[model samples]
Target chain A: MSTKNSEAGEGKERAGDVIVETVARLMVPFIQLFALYVIIHGAGGPGGGFQGGVIFGASFVLLVIAFGIVNAGDRFPEGANTAFMSLGVYIYAGVGLLCIIFSLGAAQFLNYGFIPLTTHFEENRALGMDLVEIGIGITVMAVVTSIFFNLAWKREPEEGGEEE
Target chain B: MIPSLDLVLLFLIVAIAIAAITVRDLLSAIMLLCAYSFLMAVIWVEMHAVDVAFTEAAVGAGASTAFLIAALSRTTRWEKK
Candidate 1:
């Protein structure tokens, strides 16, 4: 009888752990979407590129915490994270380079008027702002996640180990 | 009216930040940090930044807390101080 009761208790604990893990998994998509909303709407709202990007990065960090670091790393490989960071910076810098290439003005790097969005200054500004936010979000998310993983994976010094 | 609300929100944010930093227990500090994030979200809302507030609530409250707790689990929970 005691054996059966113990088995039942163990089952309950397993079920609880599964429930927590499932809820954590479900949260990732919502977090990503909310990050995007902040980035895209920052011009009309309180957030901007930096805040949005950090928030996006927080999602993966959450996954690593809620689930396990190994699981999170499996989901987002090192190569993919690096690529996203590079892509974001490239896009952001590429936009500025395009302006220089067009010879619109040398004075400004990210000034949108030089590039011309649909031949309208206002439209160009809006587009440039939107793109910048996107780039920021991507870079922030990748970099922050990388940092968390690096910290988490660092080997702890053995107890009483000799200092290097 | 909105300005008054903003003041309240700001107060809440400050309180949470103080608590988070002052807490001795790592877990408690992390949890308080989440609360601080939430209050900051409210402040963002008061500033007419709905999108920012949403992101703050989702990421700050949701993911960041998880990350902290996860990191905490890998180490000791209590502190000498």
Candidate 2:
């Protein structure tokens, strides 16, 4: 029991100075919030889905730097990461397909205005673009995080015998 | 987009690129590359391509730097002659 407790605690061990850990913990939420703003504001400004997603992934990277990879990985499990990737693609494709189905094949793929989300055609286009951007943001975030985790994770030689 | 400032940035970018290539220390090279990415992003903004600048800042400076550092961890810090 004691060993199990220690192992569990090990995952949350602080990697460096207390100040670094504190700042990371405090800053993660704000970074994520900014990421959302970037995604939403992309339609009218300099930011976009890819940039926002990267910023979001960077927050997780910051946490991994301050805390430990194991801690971050545990919080964002491999299963969930995979799911997010697929879900984002599904949302994007589904929106396009919905546009086609609703328009009776009259509209082209990704014709955002075809979807009857709102009364005005322009509003529907705008909303559809936002949805597509959101889907892109989600996928980019998951992909970036997944890449970092794969690159940074260290496997124990004794446990796996895959030291290369 | 001051002419002198643009010239200065371009010069600095060239110098940093050379330095990054010449530096034997892998870590130092990585840092130099990160600086290069950031300066390039600024140049993009100066040219009024804010979207490209944003992408450069996020992917080039931020993500790629982390990736290089992570890749570096699995190898020797210094390049062998």
Candidate 3:
């Protein structure tokens, strides 16, 4: 019983301080917005899909740090994360395939100009690049979050036969 | 961009790298590595490799630090003598 009490106390401490929680709450949305901006502006700037995605993932990490992993994990369900990982890959590959198919196989894979989204070839290329960036961003964000979740997840003491 | 700033950042990075390797506590090593990554990002930017700098800051400093800490949680905090 004393051990159980101490464990509960430990859990409470891990919940983190009120200042951290408030700051995280205030900062999360801005971080996400900046992530989108990075993704969109990547073509002409330093930021891109991977960097934006990492930033997005970092926001989730911040939440986990401020509120504990279990709380953050519960909010981002594992199933959704898995779906997102696959979905991003599909979006990425699908665009490449679309270029080939729409151009009657004359264009190589990922030839964004071959995509018919816009009447102008340059516009089509730009739009396709943006889509691919978004896809990569999604995959990377899901992957980073998933890795953190798996690494940090702790089995219940009874189930794991006590860690120590 | 300034030569002095670049020298200072590089010096700090090398010091942190050595400290990370010598630190007895795994947590401190991870934090030092994070700082090293951040400084490296600054160096990349100074060299005009803004894209590489962005990636270094995001993945090297931000994501990898969190990952190392999470991995550390599943293991011991102190280095085994």
For TM-score, the strongest prediction is: 2
- Off by more than 4 A, model 3: A1-14, A157-164
Q: For candidate 3 chain A, which ten residues in a row score worst on lDDT?
A: A4-13
RMSD of each: 6.7, 3.6, 3.1
The predicted structure with the larger TM-score, 1 or 3, is 3
- State the lDDT of candidate 2 residue by residue for A19-131, as single tens digits: 98899999999999999999999988999888999999988888887787776777988899999999989989999999999889686789999899989999999999899
lDDT for B34 (candidate 1) = 88
**Candidate lDDT (C-alpha), each:** 0.74, 0.88, 0.88
TM-score of chain B of 3: 0.94
Encode model 1's per-residue lDDT on A1-164: one tens digit a residue: 33432332321222336776788789889977877887898877667776778877887776665655544566888899899999999989988787777655565788866776778887887888888888888888888788777656433355226534
Docking quality (DockQ) of candidate 1: 0.32
Kindly list the per-residue Cα lDDT of model 2 for residues B31-79, writing each as its tens digit: 9999999999999999899999999999999989998987886678999
DockQ of predicted candidate 2 = 0.59
TM-score of each: 0.71, 0.91, 0.90
lDDT of model number 3: 0.88
Docking class of 1: acceptable
For all candidates, what are the clash counts?
Answer: 0, 0, 0
Each candidate's interface RMSD (Å, one decimal) is: 5.6, 3.5, 2.0
Global lDDT of model 1: 0.74
**For residues B17-54, could you state the per-residue lDDT of candidate 3 as single tens digits?**
99999999999999999999999998998989999999
